[model samples]
Target: MFFEGFSLVTQDVQGVRYRFRSGGTAPDAIFLLHGRPETHVMWHRVGPLLARYYTVICPDLHPERSPEQQVNDLLTLATITGHDKFVIVGQDYGAHLGYLTAATAPDRVQALVLMEALPAATHEGRDDMAFSLAQYNSCWFAQLHPKPESHTIPVPAEWLEKPLPAESVFAPEAVADYLSASIWQHARTVTWAAACHPIRCPVLVLWAASGRIGGWYDPVRRWCDVTSAPTEGHAINGLHFLAEEAPGDVETAISLFLEHCIPE
Candidate 1:
């Protein structure tokens, strides 16, 4: 089973159980965090692709835990894996939390790969961007769901038919997993509310040019401006999950970046 390496492990922290994919050699761990409404399953395809070279760990951001608690769980997981520092790859809500975890613990994060990540400030610094999908006539689920209590719009399979700009980057399985997981978890927008200060690590921001969330170029640019970490941004042709949509391109970028950070 490709999923046999995947397991649901429970952590004492907050009684939360997260999914992890265990494979690869020692010294380097590639942790994958899924966005809202999704779980470790979101990276089923991409994880194995990277797992061939590095240990890939994907954890479900169970809506039950707060952002702080989530990071703590990540740290505990890292400790359990015997890794003091590791690289992190995240998408959408996952990217948002990745920034927080990296910023809070620079020593623990060797490198960061963020896809369709939200600027920490965007959650509060700008209110005009928080319009509803009805008002904005766009997919503004994160903004609309300001709190955990807000309702989540179910993203059905039909939505994929009208592929967004970056659809080519991911395979059908990746998209299906994201859609199903997000729909199952009613509190899919909580991570959007998470914000952070500057971080001090190598950072890569991969934004989906066709993203329906706040695809504001300026906001994306500001993330590079505010981060103390050495940062670079690339506008890709995919939707939110660039890794799944364009695994080859993403793998190339990730491998090159990790080479400089992890060292052969």
Candidate 2:
């Protein structure tokens, strides 16, 4: 089993049943959120490693909830688990949710780890021909409001119309979970204005060195603009899926960041 000793749990919050995995014995907690086209399984590799030092919570994000509702779910999850202060680590769409969660409850979020995503303000403010052309597919996907369950129905490969990394890069079970539960809701981008309250907790931003993020903008600098607390950024050697392609690097970067921010 990928999760090994992790306990599989399902809890109801706000009339929604949330399925998640919990492991490790530490009092301090860390929540790992997955991006689009994936599930909590994306963190299979990194979660066990982090579990050695912290309680790790990996949850399958509900498909059709507003950003505020999603944040509420996470905050409530922490409360239910008896964690007043915890760290958040999110990727892609998950990064967006993490930002909202941190902003919604700054007192409870001790720190944040965001990968392969920029703050909404940074993205909107910097939108241009180059970015639009490069991210045309993503932009198109954002406009689509497909049925929440549309993702589960596999379409022809040609329908994707975009190149994806080889399947070998991901764990087989993880891929299976993604295929079964991935939803279009992940494509919906949350628009958080730059004028909104800045996140006060420390942040660690990680992006794919070979991906479009570095080529499109100064990720670290842009993140610094949105955070009032200390901000650090790193470029991992991989494409958009940092955790899947470079789990070791991801684990190392997060471990080092958490060590400095939440000392044992």
Candidate 3:
């Protein structure tokens, strides 16, 4: 659930409607992007709290968009809201956008935070075609998941402390939007491999434990060694879902990054 009094609005950006929940009085802005099988709702724990100090913008991104398209979408949202510059915190799929947006437009981003995501590729480049294929195999059904009926994919009981229906994860509209947008798992990987531009802004990467993510992507190595900017890597002991299982750790990492790495 969102913080009380927060308004949910849908804005048409380049003919595509994007939904977001926003409410805060702070002049500085913070954009939150959620990962797969989730919507902006994942930020309920930290978003309301973050709003106390910053204007929080959480948007539901359909997984189909490439890293660059996501960047454009977020930029459009920023322009609509009249925020020339803002901080961005994203998890899983959302983190990909956060990293790409920061790298693509250093001047537009005040700060960037990525939690438990695929590490940003450096200038050296990478070979993740197989990894992409593996994901494709796993989610093949998900892409075609809405053949006859469409609803939120039920969240497994183990993923959360308490069991919840997948419909409860995000709004029905958001769930439908994601199902419609989901596609081309391998193509997105190629996009990331090519999106390895040098980052020029302050970055905070909250990396999850090794076994939580892909076996091939070395989340720790590249994240710690990223020289594109002054980057800090903090290891979080949790599942792939950062905000859910390790909210306190995520909050602590964000607090430290904001307080020490970036100026308010």
Candidate 4:
């Protein structure tokens, strides 16, 4: 059975049971990673749209994995699919993985797309422009929970309504899958490697300009400032779920950027 237009599949790679979906006959490929509190199903709408032009793979990646481990998992998955190079797009927590994938193995990645997420820069858990209580609030919440890894973290319906409004329209199966997944196998707010490496590929940072992420620090500008590679950013109207709220904007941004990165 297909979840949306893609076939649901799982592969055991490097001792981890990785779940993902892949479809399309095109030789070119794109990988989609979801954010915390959600699964690969988060890319339901946007993934299929991109699938028309390129093979799209959406994976339920363990964000808790260290940058290096996550990158290894990604490469293994790519190898399983007979791809040495492919574009990757990530949103929110998924973008964290994207940064590492690009920085750690720049040669394997063709282009990088990040949306509503921060780079793997050093953050000391202080209340500075580099960090925010609200931005990292989920981690703070995890720390407060007595059993952060017990899969018992209660979903704050009222609190989440702001960022994920009723109109956001998440699928029931997607929400259930996200809630069932263990979100705390790794420690909360585990910073990236001691030294943040520069990404060598073309980068696109798409952000929601609705003022949710830029309260204290402009995250979009911050992303551009931290990256050493060729990078550009655009702001769109929506909540934190840019793919759900503004799929068209996401599509346009990625298509335009990939045009330059993968010029044919």
Predictions in order: lDDT: 0.68, 0.83, 0.69, 0.74
lDDT tens digits by residue: candidate 1, 81-191: 788889988887788778888877888888998877557565455536444343322444444456423443444334467464343544465556566654345453453
lDDT of 3: 0.69
Off by over 4 Å in 4: 1-3, 122-126, 129-168, 183-189, 194-196
lDDT of 4 by residue, 16-77 (tens): 89888898878888999887667788788788778888899998887666667878999899
Query: What C-alpha lDDT, on a 0 to 100 scale, does residue 131 get in candidate 1?
Result: 40
Best-performing candidate as measured by TM-score? 2
Provide the lowest-lDDT 10-residue window in model 2. 152-161
Per-model TM-score on C-alpha atoms: 0.76, 0.86, 0.73, 0.81
Ten residues in sequence with the least summed lDDT for candidate 3: 155-164
lDDT of 4 at 246: 80
- How well does candidate 4 match the true structure, expressed as C-alpha RMSD? 4.7
Shift in Å, residue 239, candidate 1: 2.4
Clashes of 3: 0
lDDT of 2: 0.83
